[model samples]
Target: MEQSGNQNITDYDLIKGSIAGDPRIQEILYQRFAPKMYAICLRYAGNNDDAQDLLQEGFIKVFRNLEKFRNEGSFEGWLRRVFVNTSIEHYRRKVHLNSISEKEEVGIEDVSVSVLDQLAERDIVQLVQELSPGYRAVFNLYVIEGYSHKEIGEILGISEGTSKSQLARAKSILQKKVAEHLGVTRK
Candidate 1:
């Protein structure tokens, strides 16, 4: 079949085709959203491998619940939410977020603007990757994913305080990593 070069395919059309069980349309939808959604998953996942897993899992949820979308907003927004939730679900399944301690949970406020300016996007992503899974999850969820501590805790099956602690630890670790990269020592 001839593929259109990123033509403006309406969500209505895509949804119709998907509901009709047209495999080609489904593939097209996947191709369209996968790259952007994969990046979202990557931010939440601790490593590239886990990111890929979350990407697949997220896509699965997207396809499975495609019909439920109410067309009240941008399809991309709806899809993005699915991918985010999928990433959170993946973490919840793999980690006991509830087990975090107050010392382990880090608040996000400690992450400084100066530090962020010192690093590029890729550098920040790498710093996040270096964090332990629990710290990384809370950091990504709160900082990157814009989830509240309460939401992060609920998603991870941990208390809000644990999420706060994890985020703080994540910030401290990231600051150290960034400082090391910049040849600076903390006072």
Candidate 2:
């Protein structure tokens, strides 16, 4: 599809152009999605440097595999999944793999309330960054990305128990942070 002078190029057009090695269209796609995807990386990375690294790596993968995007779902969703998986892959590469005992994993219950909702997205991101890599990965996958422990374990190359344990620890840490922010403690 030729780029019209006045009309915004659709995502499909950019994807097609990118796959055909059109650098301008590729740049257009990158500018369109990079900001949103960077936020995803930041949530998983715990810092700007790591998030920037993941952002670059994820875009590299996206461009390399753009032809494989089957058009079955929203292109943005597909890109977000790729970035999220890329973050997990990076985490696994850096962290030691270990099995966690069942007893150590905490059970997650649906809370009637969410303090995180009260905080700005940036503040929530900062709070999540305070967690260790393992805990942060599990938390982002399970809490933010809506992955199950089993799915997270498979992605991170850990047992389901380990994923659960890490998520529990992350929640505990986050809960304390939230409590501090609220000027209260868990009863």
Candidate 3:
């Protein structure tokens, strides 16, 4: 596929080029989506190195499965889903979500909404990264990716209640981190 004069390349073209093993199109596809996909990977990966690994693994899967795409919806959405699932798979291998006993649960007071309002997105992402892998996985799935507790449970191999509990703890810990970052004590 030759780059025509002054016309933006469609994702269909990119996918086609990539399937044909055109390095130029593969490189173009990577250049187009890597940043957004890497951000998603970073939310689930604990650190930069792991995030890069997820990015690499995800793109590998994306290229390998590009032919499976049915053209039913957004290409970017499909790519995002692949990246998120790759991150989840990475977390799944590293940590098992052992159910926490109720007696060990910690309570956290809800902070003012302004706390999140005050923080930059990078600050919020950093706080999320500070979470343990189990908490981070649930938090990313439910909170960021908009998967429900039931869906998250199925994906992570935990019960729905456990999914909810992890999200609660993740939120609670995040609130404290945000409070500390903002120099405001949570009551």
Candidate 4:
């Protein structure tokens, strides 16, 4: 795992070196992916300290299970799944997903895409972070990670109805937050 004069080592080599316990290669692998992975963690964890913990836990899982990674897809894709699952596990431990009452499940108005398009990426992340854990998990899994409500229910140990409800609730709250951020009144 010695560094060649050129800094363009491939992921295959990095994986092999890391699996073989090469410290330099492990560090390189971590440096290459940590930033993007941390964003995933922050999206799920909603704060710096929890995100940091999830990131560390995710890398540990990544390194421990590196040998299980077949070369079928991009390494970063695999890494994303790991971090996202780690974040979900953390969420599960911290909060129990409960079904909202019928009275509380109001119809959600569609937030205009233009309002979302106007905000900075950080503002969007901040707004998402403000969501409660159940709402946040469902939103990230459904909207961000592209999981169906059924899949999200299986992952989060809730019913599919609950998953859909949580996502609707998350969107409703985010709609309000976006309007407030844009200083627009909702009729």
Candidate 5:
């Protein structure tokens, strides 16, 4: 137990302490990852209140499942997976994807895409937040999390085509919103 200080305590040590049910180490771990994880929660949530709820719920799951961690890959990655899954599951309980549009319009594939270079990260995230829940989920899963359409289909219980269609619609919707923000018409 190299408890020199919070900074000196490795993630392995923190996980072990959390597994042993030490409140102090759990607190340390929470303090360490909460900000980043909260950002993720916020992206999936409709607003800050839900983001806070997701954050608290995510930390609870992390501590409860601390013993199951195999220490295989980055612990942060594992923790992120847990948080993403938590958000997905929480969202699943709250909404259905039936309303996600099935229309896949042409021309988006050839779009230059450089318009985003002019925008800040906060601006883009705000645009993503403006999407419907299904569109938002597909966008985050495909773009931010780097999940393949097939994997998204499996996770979200939609068909692969549905996942792809939802992502396309989300992108189309975002493009329109961004164009509106910039006061330019889509080409």
Candidate 6:
């Protein structure tokens, strides 16, 4: 291992050193990715305390499973998948997703792209944070993480229809919240 500082070390070297049980390398890897991972954790967790916990848990998973990475894709991408899965696992443990009835699923309005574009990213994240756990998981998985409904269903142990309904409900709620935040009526 290079005794040089983190600045000069490549990700490859960091991975190798971490796999070899080098505490310094593991810390460096955590420092490099924690901010972005924390953002993801916050998005799924919907609060700082849970986000912090998720971040720590995600890193533990990453370090424990570091040897499984085959280098076929970007390490950052792999790290993101791990954190997202960790967050989803946390959500599953805390919430039992109930499918919305057809009667309740009716009248879900889509938010305009223009309205969403008007808000800052932080504002958007805050709005998303207000979503219920099931809605939030479906929203993040389908919209942010780019998973298909079937994929989300499998990940969250729900039906594809349930995932679709959850996402629709999440969008509807967000639209209403955004409208209220901007002092605009949806009618």
Write down the TM-score of every candidate: 0.86, 0.87, 0.91, 0.92, 0.88, 0.91
Write down the lDDT that model 5 would get: 0.85
Error of 5 at 37 (Å): 0.6
lDDT of 4 by residue, 19-84 (tens): 999998899898888899999999998698999999999999999999999998999999999999
lDDT of 6 by residue, 1-187 (tens): 2345667888899899999999988888888889999999999987899999999999999999999999989999999999998999999889888767766656554444358889999999899999999999999998899999999989988877777778877887888898899999767
Q: What is residue 149's positional error in candidate 4, in angstroms?
A: 0.5
Q: Mind giving the per-residue lDDT tens digits that candidate 5 earns over 83-122?
A: 9999999889998985533454333352234577778888
C-alpha RMSD in Å of predicted model 5 compared with the true structure: 3.2
lDDT of 6 at 184: 94
**Per-residue lDDT over 1-187 for candidate 3, one digit per residue giving the tens place of the 0 to 100 score:** 2345313878999999999999988988898888999999999988999999999999999999999999988999999989988998898888888578655544433333347878899998899899999988998898789999999989999877778788888888888898899898756
Error of 3 at 157 (Å): 0.8
Candidate 1 per-residue lDDT over residues 2-39, each given as its tens digit: 26764577677777788787898888887877789988
| TM-score, cand. 3 vs. native | 0.91
> lDDT per prediction?
0.79, 0.84, 0.86, 0.88, 0.85, 0.88
Task: Give the lDDT of residue 160 in candidate 1.
Answer: 79
- Model 4, residue 121: C-alpha shift (Å): 0.7
Clashing pairs in model 3, backbone N/Cα/C closer than 3 A? none
Prediction 6 global C-alpha lDDT:
0.88
* Residue pairs whose backbone atoms clash in candidate 6: none
Q: Return the clash pairs for model 5, or none.
A: none
